[model samples]
Structures are given as C-alpha cells and as structure tokens.
Target: MTIPKSVFVVDLNYVVTLPEIDAHIPGHVEFLDQCYEAGLFLASGAKIPRTGGVIIASAPSRESLEAHLAQDPFHINGVAEYKITEFQAKKHKPNFFD
Candidate 1:
C-alpha cells in the first residue's frame, strides 16, 4: 500500500552539555515511544559523535509535524533544537512499500 504522507528527517542538535541530555533521556525516550505508537516516527537514534540524534518520520503536513515535535521533552526543556527536512522516497528494498 502507498502512504500519502510526506517523509521528514528530524535533526536534533544539542544546545547544552551531555549531563543535560542525560537528565532528560527518560522523558525523551518516553516521547519517542509515544511518537512511535502514534505512527509519526519510523526510526531514530543518537549521532555517532554523541552530539544529537536523528529521526525518520512522516506527517500529513509540515505544520502538523512541527506541532507534534514541539511536544518532545528535548524541545520542552530546550535541550535540543530541531531541524526538519522533508523528502521523497523513490526507492526501497522489497516489502518496504507494504
């Protein structure tokens, strides 16, 4: 089946030190779980340099995506800033489109 929603790449850049990020990890993880359950997030993980993280998601519109991202604990506590990029998925492995 084809999904009509737009794909987004959420880049989280940490503004504070590692301790602050650590302090909010629990809430941040909870937020991620909520996003997953809501079908907003497809995948996510920390950066190799430990600076921040990235999230692959989909939304009906940019406005809606920003609204949902605003609810993240990292955003709430100003621990990180988000840069959202929208893109088209032109290719994938077998069954990826299902």
Candidate 2:
C-alpha cells in the first residue's frame, strides 16, 4: 500500500529548565539535520523565550513520525513534551522552496 504524505506541526514544550535544554541542543540539532537530510523536516527553530521549539515536517504516517521524533535527544532525555498536529498542505508559493 502506498502511504499518503502527511504534514505535521510539532510543538515542543519544555518540561525542564533552559539550561537542561541547552545541554542537549547539540544532539537535538544533529537529529534535526538527519531529518532534513532524509526529507522529513522542512523547518525548525526555538521559541522566542527559549521555552521550547517547533518543527514542520512531513511523514508517511503519524506513527512513523512519532517514532522518528522519539529519537530526538530532548525526547530521549525527557526534557520536553511534544504536541503534534497534522495538517493538509493544500497550497504553497511557487518559490517557497527557494
């Protein structure tokens, strides 16, 4: 069976302090890079107050996406809780990828 493409908005809420979050940033970034290389992540960044972060990604299924997210250092270390919302990307600018 062919899996449909699903877009997800991953909202990360810090469960620990900022210093704790910082301690794992390098690993988190490495994970993000891997996701990007695999065409799973579109964009990602921290919140204004550094409380957490957000990631825009696409996956074949929610389960698979969740599995991939579980590999993040933040998740592994229990430093943050992730709230994932799936949405349909019906349209986009022609140059949006540029």
Candidate 3:
C-alpha cells in the first residue's frame, strides 16, 4: 500500500507583460512536464478567473515543496512568483483515486 502524502497548494497572482508572457507560459509547461516525470506535481493548471496558477504537489515538507517549485523556469526567469500554502483536505468515497 502507498503511504499518505502531504499535498501542497500553490497560488500564483499573475504576470502581465511581453517578457512574462513569453517566459512564463512555456516555462510553466516545461516545468509541469518535468514534475510529471518526477512524480511530484500530481496535477497543475491555471486558476479559475484567469488569475494565475494552481498546483497540487506532494513533498516531504513545505521547504522541500517550495524547492521543487523553485525549479520551475517561470520562477527562475523572474517572470512569475508563487505563494505556497498548506492545505488540509478531506475525501471520502468508494473510489477516492478515481
């Protein structure tokens, strides 16, 4: 059986500019792909209302989680920023993984 994990929630405000547009989107996509390959960011996408980004990631600790996110190109290129917040979620169903 798999052990329970800590799922972190990341909220990105937004970036409005040509440099940010060119750097942020592609960078985020590349980072997301890497996360998928690494098995850390289970799921990630843009937020509702088109504000910014939302990522659901699993890590050992908040610092580790931030480090993982820091690898994202958007962050490295100074085109984007993130607010990492811890979350406590409850789920119950016949098929939780479904």
Candidate with best TM-score: 1
List the candidate 3 regions with Cα displacement exceeding 4 Å: 1-3, 92-98
Model 1 segments more than 4 A misplaced: 95-98
- Which order, best to worst by lDDT? 1, 2, 3
- lDDT per residue as tens, model 2, 1-98: 22236889999999988888889999999999999999898899999988889998888899999999999999999999999999977776554332
Order of models, best TM-score first: 1, 2, 3
Query: TM per model?
Result: 0.92, 0.90, 0.76
lDDT score for candidate 2 against the true structure: 0.88
Angstrom error at residue 47, model 3: 2.2
The count of backbone overlaps in candidate 3 is: 0
For each candidate, what is the lDDT? 0.89, 0.88, 0.71
**Candidate 1 local lDDT, 1-98, one digit each (tens):** 47545888999999999998999999999999998898888889999899999999888999999999999999999999999999887765555533
lDDT of 3 by residue, 33-85 (tens): 98778777766777677667788776778888888877877777666668887
Residue pairs with backbone overlap in model 1: none
